[model samples]
Target chain A: MLTILLQHTVFGIVTGSILLLATIGFSMIYTTKRFLCISHGELLTIGAYTTYIFHVFLGWNLLYSGVIGVVITSLVGLAIARGLYEPMERHGPLVLLFTSVGVTFCLHGILEFIAGPSIRSFRTPILPSIRVGGIPLITMNEIVIISIAMGSIVFLHVVLTRTRIGKAFRAMASNVDLAMARGIDTARISMFVWIYASAMAAVAGILLALVTSVNPDLGWTQILIILAAAILGGLGSIYGVMIGAILLGVVMDVGVIFFPSGYRAAIAFALMIIVLLVKPKGIFGGE
Target chain B: MFRRTRIVRRVLVVGLSLALLAGLSVGVARAEEVRFGVLTSLSGPLGTEGKPCFETIQWTVEEINKFGGPLGMPIKLFVADTATDVERGITGARKLITMDRVINIIGPSSSIVVAIMKFCADNEVPIISHWSGSTRLTTSGGEYQFRTCPDDYFEGEVAARFMWDEGFRKAAVITLDTEDTISISDALKKRFAAMGGEVVVDEMVVGGQTTYRTAARKVLAKRPDVLFPAIDLDTLKIVYRELYEMGITFTVVLASNAVQQATMDIVGADILEGVYGEKPANALGSPGYAIFEQKYREHMEDGMVGWFTPNMYDAVNLMALAVEVAGEATGKGISENIRKVANSPGIKVYSYAEGLAHLLRGHEINYEGASGSCDFDEFGNVLGYARIQQAKGGQWVDIKFYSSEDLAEAIR
Candidate 1:
């Protein structure tokens, strides 16, 4: 019984790690840019597919291809922010939100057209997994996933709290008009946030593709839980999103022990709803 | 003048109603050229399988046309690309039945076949398929619905019997939560239990998820004697990879759904070795298949046929033979005579020409085509042949072949 519990928790952590990285960007953009970028998930798809193109099609090394994939994905996200969202900034939240939805469809269609509908994976040598005392806890790829998730959380913490740009970003989130009047250059900062967060999500995508299979719907499938994680941790709360992601992951994974696997997604949302009912401002109570 | 106007108005009303009645039902087979609907995917995900299935069926039509095209009228194939999708398939099927006026139609892939079935049933059009393998299509096999391939239900039985024969006493089943997998699992559970094997664990995980580790562990905790995974072909390899990571010791026998090259290639070689499963392949020992192979090679280089191409070839030939047997080019005519021409208790004919000749001479003809004996039971599915394939080295090795009857005998 103890082994089974540990095993499920391990699975949950791995799931939460992926969700953390994917949702971090979503929460960051919401805090600074002040609108839910619905197409944010497609950046994850673009990342994995671009890596696939480099590694599988171009025959580059997986590591180098992953770097290139991340770079390319960040650039695409930057372009989307600058090209689409920035220009429509004055048009109110509703217009920008609908535009993001349109952007989601366009990006999805483009990915479907280019990559086609088949599931693909990188050609990598399979290594034996690390098992302890008859319980299979982790694999090498999963280790990489957990490590990256932790690293990104720490990285985001330092960049937002400790760095000078962090203070400016906080100022913008607190009062955009006052921050701009105080010479913070809010527009460049918003674009910077998109690029950095998109790069982080792309890293998550490559790790995701390595551990699991990569398909056209790779990111779209995870977007719902990502939204739940963001909301559960308090929408637009960076640190809160991290905690929410891991907790939801563990809950869904362990929940399988009690409920059927079909209710995995439902488990995450149920926790979010419960948390919201208890504290309407969410766990961290983001402004 | 008033009397003349009233006469004109009455004539116009009668003429308009007659035209409207004719427009309600689409064109059936016409004089000079007979229209037949080929509803297969020309593009999209299943297009890889769909395109080849369509080509082989198209080639068979061309071959039959050389010999006067089934009842002295040239067969005109009105092709509709389903794009390997259900919505497109439904729309394309509608166009074929209501617009193009085809006598009979070969519908799209498995899921699409289920979707457009009611529409075709309502319109009263006969469907011949090589792609659809879901058992749902055949449960209460109605008129105007028939497939020239084995359905998932029989494949499920084969898995159960195979597991039983392999000395597996305790069976665990993990499958996708789709209707097709349900059909396979339902049959497998019934048959395996009837054979005195205990199903210790049964899990139906949802598709499109990243991992099924929790579900896998839940099934593994039971420590069953064997595992039967009716998972989605894409997810199957991923699950096996996870199980291997977790130190899998039990044996796994897969359903025929996982028997494809694309899957094996992505999953890699040697990973699935000793994993035994059944796949519907050509009847290598049958002369009917041998001759079909020879002709196929003559047309294309390498002459490789995909999974259901032979069954599709048999489907078209059966349609032609049935058309000749019925002596009319209507859906009713073909549906009534389909079983008569394909089933036994008649002289077995291999080629379309041979079947046509036999039918023309007032002789009952049974089609023994590229697929094994093209026999349709009351369920309207052919008793197709399947080869038991075990993954070895980097390729699927054929251990042995089993006919539908052979499988039934073993189950008995």
Candidate 2:
């Protein structure tokens, strides 16, 4: 019984790591842009497919292909911000949100057209998993996922606290008009945020594809849970989103012990609803 | 008064010409063709199977027209995309019956078929589904409904009996919580219990989730002698990978729903070796299958075919044969003659042309087509054989064939 509990918790953390990576980007984009970016999840799909094209089809090294995929996804996010969002900036938040929904469908359609709406996987050689202290059995892939996610979180914390550009980002995130008045270029900062967040989403996508299988609707399927994480964590705070993702992930995995496995997503949503009922502005939201 | 009389004469001439043209066109349309509705999912997740099924139907119709069609009239196929959605399927069925005036319908998924069963029954249009395997579909008293594939109820019984024969006493099931999966798993569980076997764990996984680690842990804890997975390809891949990573080993008896070339490819041959599965036998040894393979390769992209390809081929040929046997181009006539042309006490014919020739000679014909002997019981369900297959050396190898009687004995 204890071993089962340990196994479930370890697996939950692995799932939580992916959720953390995804929610960070989702929360970052929503906070800076001030509209729900429904197409943000498409960045993950783009990253995954792009990596598959390079590594599997074009015969590139897996790590190099992943890097290139992340770069391409980041560029796509920057393009969306400049080409679509910037042009429609004056149309108010609801219109911008609806436009993102349209962009989501458009990106989804393009993927379906290219990938033929079937599941695909990276053609990697299989490796045996390692047992840690002969207790909880985990795979090398799981270790890699957790390591990268943690590394990114730490790197993001240092950058946001220590760097000049990071300070400017924080300023804009807090008060865009004030930051602009203080001579920080709001447009440049927003573009950088889009690129960075999308890059994070790309990493999440690649890791997820490695863990499971890749399909055109991979990101679309998980967008709801990512949204739940972001909203549960006050929608904009990086650290808050991290905590929220871990909580939701653990709850989802552990909840299956008490309930049937199908209730995983329901438990997450129920937790979110309870949080909202108790604290309407979210657990960490100010005012 | 003179100008008014001239205008009235011009109007009268134009009106008479318009009415005469409409009547002539209607008369020509009625004489030239018989239309049939081909309803199938052409765009969604099922499209992979649905497209090829539709193409087989289309190709068969073309072949029929080349041989002077079923009843000396050119057959016109009116296809409507169901999109694999229930509401769209209902709408498509309605439009086919009401607008296109089709005599019969062919090929939609089980859920869509069930959703539109009453609609077809009300219109008295015969719907022959080639892919749907739900038992409730044929048993629901929709006399107009028929299916070419064996139902899941039989598959479930076979699975339970196979497990018992293999000496697996404690069984665990992990299935997707959909109607089809649930029904099949329920049948298996009930039958397994009836055979005095214990089901240790039954886990229902939701669709579209990234991880099944929790579910995997639960199943592992049960430590059953065998695992039966009735999940989709994607989820199955994840669950198996997780199980392997956790160093858990058990015999996996996959449900027929998970037995596909795509599933094998995605899950990797190394992981899936020795896994047991079952599918409706395609009767690959039959001469009709050889002909189908040769002709199907010429038109299909990638030169690839699925297990259900033969079923689709048989569906089209059966409908055409019934049309020929009925000697008329109406739904009721085809309905009356379908069983007569499919069952025994008749000359055996394989293809549409052979059946047509036999019918033209005033002889009864039984079709043993690419899928197998096309036989339907009283409930519009086929008593088909199931092929027990195992993953061996990166390919599925057929081990044994179990007929309906054999399955019945096992269940008994």
Cα lDDT for residue B350, model 2?
A: 80
Worst 10 residues of 1 chain B by lDDT: B23-32
> What TM-score fits each model?
0.88, 0.91
The DockQ of predicted model 1 stands at 0.38
Fnat for model 1 comes to: 0.40
lDDT of 2 by residue, B311-360 (tens): 88888888777877777777887788898888898998888888888888
lDDT against true structure, model 1: 0.80
DockQ of each: 0.38, 0.46
TM-score of 1: 0.88
User: Residue A150, candidate 2: how far off, in angstroms?
Assistant: 1.4
Interface RMSD of 1: 2.8
